[model samples]
Target: MQILEEKTLGIKSWSPEDRPREKLILKGRASLSDAELIAILLGTGTATMSAVDLAKRILLCADNNINRLAQLTVKDLVKIKGVGEAKAISIIAALELGRRRKSSDADKPAITSSKLAFDVLKSDLTDIPHEEFWIMLLNRGNRVVKKQKISLGGVSGTVADPKIIFKLALDELASGIILAHNHPSGNLEASVADLDLTRKLKEGARLLDIQILDHLIIAEDRYFSFADEGLL
Candidate 1:
């Protein structure tokens, strides 16, 4: 096995024209291959392969499924042939840091309307494989106080009790809330269960004085707002 030293098998091995970093600099990040993009994070590899090769192997382990990357734990990364503790920790830390950064950015704006609520939750909920019910907690002014996942299950069968929903709102001291759920089938239309749940929640919220602002059904790149349809 050829050991990959910083000088030998690292970025130094690639000619100026063939180097990923240089190519990214000359062109753009969009121009880089997936292996190159991952290799930049990996930094280096073991004796048997370069970082790019290691990245290719990692993607292969994911069966080329990008979402599978989210499922990977530190132990899973370390189990890969060339990924040691340092590399595994670095990768996991990078992923987590990115998630926190996105969440922080998402948390900045208050969700006043159904449109605003959808904007805040869409990015996270759109790609989910299963149905996830989330509550967007809002202050008296309608700015977002926090967002919390209330439950998860299949599309038509997911059940989220009003008590469970209200508990989090009470805990957060939220004056208003938005209910959001995803359709795994990529259909934004509300099911009968969706409408029933929304009606039930709105009735419950009215009694508790916690306003139900909207019920949004999210699919890929599309969404249905009950409020927009005068259903709220």
Candidate 2:
């Protein structure tokens, strides 16, 4: 009976050096496998399986793709046995922290032209399904201070208020600003409303002594630049 009990003790039956937490401490976090890292987040196993085994199953379900694992919703995670709400939340929080760490470490580059602006923002805006207006605030040397989402709306259009924009500019002490918005329809032409808003924002920025660099209309694979067209 002692042998049976010992056999059923799951991860504890392994040597201490083989345990995920113990291995991480001995070899440093960078040396641990993906399953071991997830096992640490889970912290415990089910009655029949070890935490590492469960983590391995989860990774296999994602086809060993880290991005697919990161995109898993809590509902999707809880479909697996032993991954209750608490465990699901823990996994999600860990993934989000990793994403934020990468974003914080990335250096914001200077915006030199409309082409550069498109290159910087295309990846973020191109695949989004709905309309979103974003602002890139810059310092005196054209280095990006921050990127902020101003508004979100349906497939048609979104609103961008001049007062709210300048408020953020005031808060960030931005010397120059570039406005960008996406068209979900994949149309690169600027709408009448788009041109009107650009003019209003330009007039407003001039009053505040802040330079309005350009207004960009982002589509699926192309963009329209107001400054490049001599509209700014």
List where candidate 2 sits over 4 angstroms from the true fold: 1-9, 105-132, 154-159, 178-232
The local lDDT score (0 to 100) that residue 182 gets in candidate 2 is: 95
> How far does residue 39 in candidate 2 sit from its true spot (Å)?
0.8
Name the weakest run of 10 consecutive residues (lDDT summed) in model 1. Answer: 98-107
Global fold similarity of model 2 (TM-score): 0.64
Assess candidate 1 and give its TM-score to the true structure: 0.69
How do the residues 1-232 of candidate 2 rate in per-residue lDDT, one tens digit apiece?
4554444557877898888899888888898899999999999989878999889988988888776687688899999887899999999899878666644515767889999888766655655568999998899999888878899989989999888899999899999999999998888888899999999999999999999999999986589999999988
State the lDDT at 28 in candidate 1.
92
Cα-lDDT of candidate 1:
0.79
| Error of model 1, residue 113, in angstroms | 3.5
Which candidate number would show the highest lDDT if scored against the true structure? 2
Error of 2 at 217 (Å): 9.2
